[model samples]
Target: MSTRRYILDTNVLLQDPLAIYAFDENEVVIPAVVLEEVDSKKRNMDEIGRNARYVARLIDELREEGKLHLGVKLTNGGTFRVELNHRSFGKMKEHFLERTNDNRILAVALNMRIEEEEKQSGITVTLVSKDALLRVKADALGIHVEDFLSDRVVQYDRMYTGYKELSSESKQIDELFENKKLLIKDSPISNSYPNQFFILKDEVNPSRSALGMTSKDGNYLESFVSSEEPIWGIRARNVQQRMAFELLTRDDIPLVTLAGKAGTGKTLLSLAAGLYQTEDLQKYKKLLVARPVVPVGKDIGYLPGEKEEKLRPWMQPIFDNLEYLFNTKKPGELEQILAGMGSIQVEALTYIRGRSIPEQFIIIDEAQNLTKHEVKTILTRVGEGSKIVLMGDPKQIDHPYLDEYTNGLTYVTERLKHLSETGHVKLQKGERSGLAQMAADLL
Candidate 1:
């Protein structure tokens, strides 16, 4: 078999700084233009900037092995080269333009393909990029292309739903309800994971049903502790919501992840549970809420105000939920209430670093916009008696480099789904309103 060459784009490196090592034994090529773009992004104050710095450092260390311009051998038995030649502009058509960095990178791949053809080497030169437009352009220019697939955990369709439904006999359902616990070891259901929820239905009498969550031992199925009680006047409207409430109200499960579409009550339910645990039960000293400050549409220019005023627009939805829970009507009444309580705090995800929070109920909303590393940092900040809830809709990710499968919320859920101290529930039904549910389903 002939060797294959992979030309990586700038976005691929910024998305995964160690992407060069993921090509197996294939030869890796880094276009000089990609280096320029990455260098320009090193000063950014976001995750992309951090990844850019890491890539730069990695390349610099690789320089110690030998000159990068000339090829250096990687540990994986592949040659790595920094391509400095961009003289293949005549190979591409007119519409691609010659001055852009993307075109320059394309020129490098075109040159490699031309060289392979001239030498009769029978080598395949493919462009690996994360930009869909760049991949299309490469295909138009007759260059083979692929997206960076190293970071994608699973396809959206095959993602874990955190629950399952099983049909059983009426007697079995009654046993689960009466005894409150049943062993599922010899049951036909296979591969039952820990912390997974289930909806058991009676096959003989389809009307009889019960909800159960698998024990940490993955042996017994236990009924929910409390699903009938309301949290801060918010009752569980559906079975999924009741399951989520069971996990949220538990003191033993320190981490909980809720995922669903818009209008599924992910945020509202999490906030209600946090408030109840902190204010009513006195389980924690403070209720802290924070979310990533990702922009949906065009970002308004910097506003002039203090911390609360600057955060007002971004935190408005949270304040709205709090107002609904408190049933406050007058303007500024919610603020006055929060101030008098002196236990609730709302801040941005940017200000949460370098702080140790103990005895607090922390809610990180819109967490699907965070990176895996950012999520790890947030989870590590959980001090002695703190409980952190991560809730987000994977389909509504706003981060430029994240998708449904690669977001931090999905990453955390997949990694910690089987842990004894963690619980997860994927809400299926949207209970906001008829119109909202229709829009969420259709739009």
Candidate 2:
């Protein structure tokens, strides 16, 4: 097969520093303008900055092997080079006169296509980028463009819901209810993941149903174990919420992920379970609630105040749930209540790095805004005797580089579904209210 050239954009590298090695036996071209873009972001103190520095270091190491401008051999049997000669705007200036870094990168890809066609080298050139507008422009200019797909865990439509429905015999459903555990071999499901929930219906009468979950060993489908009792004055309003409660309250499961649309009760249920475990059952020492501070629309810039005051705007949604759980209606009353209760801690995910948290009920709200690497960093901080719950609406992601399928919450749910110590639930019904549910569904 003829070799193909893949020109990468700066966002591709910043999104994943190891993207250069993803193309096997194909030439990877990094436009010199892209390097300049990376350099501009290297001083940032966030994840983007870290990725920029890492990419720079990787390219620097490659420079020692051979001249980067000339090209260097990659470990994956691919060639890497910094394309400097394609700096001219050329025909691209006729359309995009902005002379932006994005246009510069596009120029390189456009020039390479022209060069290959002129030489009749039979080499296909493609532009790999995460920017939608850039991809459109590249296509208009008659260049092939593709999204960075290496980090995507699953398609959004086919994403794991953590629950499935199965048809079983009436006798088997009765047996499952009677014995409390039915062998998987006798069920309709040919295979089952650990902690996966099931809605078993009688094949003869579909309405005759029972809720069950796969045994940690994947051998038996056991009945749901959570009681009907209200947790922190909150009861599971639906089957999926019940499944989420079962996963959240289980001490053996250290990792629980809940994904849903807005008003699906993901956050309220997680918060209730965390409070019950930490405050009522005395299972955990603290209830640590946190979320990524990703703004929905345009940012309002920085706020002036101490840490707690600064976090109030970003954390108000969490506080609304807390006030409801605590039954505190007065303004500023929740703050005083929280201050007295040392075991309950609400903070931002920013400070969670490099800290070992043990014996805590941790709830990471708005987790869909996090990247896979950010999720790994947060999970690695969990010490012994800690349960971390990740809950978010994948469809409502606010992160610039993340989408429904590529967000951290979706990545964790898909990757860790088979682990015995992990549980996941995708809440479909919105329990917040009629208007909220309608908005979530129709809007």
lDDT of 1 by residue, 1-443 (tens): 32899999999898899999998888899999899999998988678889999999999989998999887888887878899875578776575765688888888888788889889998999999988898998898788999998898776587778889899888778888899987888775436767788898889877878889888887788887686798899999999999899989988899999999988888889889999999999999999999777652123347887778988888888888899999999999999999999999998887886689999999999989888888998999999999999999998878887888888999999887768899889999999999999999988
Best by lDDT: 2
For each candidate, how many residue pairs have backbone atoms clashing (under 3 Å)?
0, 0
TM-score each candidate: 0.95, 0.96
In angstroms, the error of model 1 at 65 is 1.3
Stretches > 4 Å off in candidate 2: 186-190, 225-227, 295-302
Error of 2 at 423 (Å): 0.3
User: In model 1, which regions exceed 4 Å deviation?
Assistant: 188-190, 295-301
* Candidate 1 backbone overlaps, count: 0
The TM-score between candidate 1 and the true structure equals: 0.95
Output the lDDT of residue 35, model 1. Answer: 93
* Candidate 2 lDDT over residue span 1-443, tens digit each: 43699999999999899999999989999998899999998987777888899999999999998999988899989899999897778778789999888898988999899999999999999999999999999999999899999989896488888889888889889989999988887545538788898898899998889999889877888996674668999998999989999999888899999988888898888889988888889999999998777652223346887888888888899999999999997898998998898899988887676799999999999889888888988999998999999999888878877788888899898998889999998899999999999987888
